[model samples]
Target: MLRCSHVLCKVDDIAAVVRDYRDLGFTVEWGSAPGRAHNALLWFGSGPFIEFFELPPVFGLLRHPFGLVHGGPAGERLARWARPGEGWRDLALETDDTDLARARSALRTAGLPVSRVIRGRRTRPDGARVRYQYLASRPAGLPFVVSAYDPPQRPARVVHANGARAVARVRMGVAPADRARYAALVGEDRWLSAVPAATTGVLDVELEGLSGPLDPRKLHGALLAAAREERG
Candidate 1:
């Protein structure tokens, strides 16, 4: 089953997002930009890491190819109508199938359309190169997007923030109709829902943080700042 991947916050400072996550006790990591604006990946504790991406092309590449707007409010909008966690976002699965082609076929037969597969370079701190693949093509404003990754040189955790053991859940605000469809996509039995407009941000996810207590407000502010930086 696919689990939540880190939520994307469309921002204008790739660096500030890193700082914000770092301030929250999460280890934020950076790699050389694939191009254009910077992309920062933050590993909060174990397996779940949020990636902040700048630039429209990069964001579009990761999300739904056929974009649509599903909303809770009229005035709030962001880049190509793909606001934070809005639309059919991606959730990754730890599959026995690492070969992307096999996984894509399975998803297609399951009913989720394969949008596109992205192949790129990821680098480690020591400058080692890692081949990266991201799979997508789910419709917009739906509940979940699915992705699979393979690291050619280093482990996926190496380029991404490490420490998170497993993703617990991701909460986002969406129209009631949209939410229901999404829940169905994720398999209703495993997904949860709340009243429409109950939550504020586009997406909210929980990571199995390290032992001890971590404050949600602190993490929220850091995430906001990073989003702002992406804009500026």
Candidate 2:
């Protein structure tokens, strides 16, 4: 089954952003740490999760080619100007691939671009050895990242806060050109109207009645508080 796994958020402050999700009542799950080289997942009940992937300290938002490719920063022009949170970063889908072959074919048949599969074993702080398969690529500059759950690695189900449910409609604000390409590539007609709003340079994830609109400012405050509580 195809499910929206996580919404990737490229942020300047990982802790702060993470806390925000927790404050909003979502159960926050931290991934392999060391901050810079890792990411965190905020479970939104069942399958849908929101992840915060940090940019290496040595590099700014736009410094990496991958970031730039997905509407992030590029070169040394200072990506901070592009704003802290923006763009329809990436969409991750979950698949159970025992052989890891059939999962690849589905993406090909759908004409979605595919990237090399990365294999690695991650040790959780609790001493759980989790193995994962990461497949990602930009289909026409629109990212389609797929991940298969390896049972022996970690539990397939993630538990978030109670009453945390993903509403049917989630608005992804994007540039007209990019938005059109995304709709065509994903093969979904989620875009309500063809009319594009002014360029905020930041991708806004609009939740129907959850919390109106989400941005870095509100997120930062909430995440910081959660981290402090978690640390204490």
Candidate 3:
């Protein structure tokens, strides 16, 4: 079973993007991973967080060993397909198995178009190290799943000014004709939902916000739209 670990929003300037989300009432943090890229993590208590990546100007022109471009070299191929400006670019899934080889095999057997497993690591300012393995697929807009080889300790709870508690659901927009194809890729996950979109990629996300309901689209950027999901 796969659950959303986080969503990756590609942007040019990390600081500006952070400021935008902060104004929306989310607590965004700055961090970088080795030479990969810089990021801002939008914390929503538990469950999944939103990871925004600030890609380098030479990203597309560079030859990334991993094939696709976002997460690492493996994403080079996928990155080439991404457009400029801020928008949802990648969606990561969490899995129980931590073995990279087994994880790759499982996806292949299940018929997902996944690339070879790629290793990645990052060290926090406090000296904490995060290690994980992931596989990127060219299909379905370069979505990937990763298993933590060494997971980081959970951080303290954050008080959201907008009242968002957790991510309720991620709404991805797909071409009308490719709806079934994308749906099959997403499998049968309850938390992740897909709708026919005029364009393909992440349309919007729903969150459990405190100040009633919220949509990221109403905040800014059409690449990702957000809504508040009611909790029982």
Candidate 4:
């Protein structure tokens, strides 16, 4: 089954962004390879976390033979989208199934774009190894699929001062006209949902915290809006 794994936030400065989140009582860790886009990860217990990264300035200008640039097409697109300011950019879904062929077949049957599963790996500063398979979406705004071969263990740093526990749900804002298209893209998933609103991107995310519900936006404006919406 598809589960909302995390959300990607593109920013202009990693250090500043990390500080902003840290001030909000959330543990942030720097985790980016040299020569690539700078990034930091925020762990939200056992549920979805947030990934913040900054695209290289020259990303859009460079073009590759495969129609990609410095950080590939996704990076280029994110660079453009974040030009206005930092906010929600990408959503990720997780599944236990590691069979790419079967996953592709299922997505294709649902009439969704299915790219060849690509393998990815990264090593943590403490010598932990991480590996996963990624499947890019067609429209680019929808959540991408990530199947982890060796999912990282929930660290002791999962606790937060803000009383936040886990990501409850994600709501995507879309134009009324494109509702059907976006709905089909998301399918009928419980952890993920969409609604017609003034915007056409990630609307808000809900978090289960000790103080009931918390919206990340209240803590940081640049941090995309995240709030709990009744799932009925």
Tell me the spans in candidate 1 whose CA falls farther than 4 Å from its real position: 33-37, 56-96, 143-148, 152-168, 174-181, 188-202, 207-232
TM-score of each: 0.58, 0.59, 0.79, 0.76
List per-prediction Cα lDDT, in the order shown.
Answer: 0.45, 0.47, 0.65, 0.64
The candidate with the higher lDDT, 1 or 3, is 3
Model 4: residues with Cα > 4 Å off, grouped in runs:
32-37, 62-84, 210-232
Give lDDT: candidate 1, residue 162: 27
**lDDT of candidate 1 over 1-232, digit per residue (tens):** 5554455545545565566556655656565643433666655434445666555443444332222322211111223334443122323333333445665566667666554444556566666665555454334444333334444221345322323444455555656545544554455323233336642234545444233344544453222222121223
Compare the candidates by TM-score and give the number of the best one.
3
Q: In model 1, which range of ten residues has the least summed lDDT?
A: 69-78
Of candidates 4 and 1, the better by lDDT? 4
Model 2's lDDT to the true fold? 0.47
Measured with C-alpha atoms, the lDDT of residue 195 in candidate 3 is 74
Put down candidate 2 lDDT per residue, 59-130, tens digits, no spaces. Answer: 454446644443221222223323345324554555665343566577657665554454656666565666
Flag regions of model 2 displaced more than 4 Å. 33-37, 57-88, 98-100, 139-141, 152-163, 173-185, 188-203, 206-216, 220-232
Candidate 3 Cα outliers beyond 4 Å, as residue runs: 33-37, 63-65, 68-82, 140-142, 176-181, 210-232
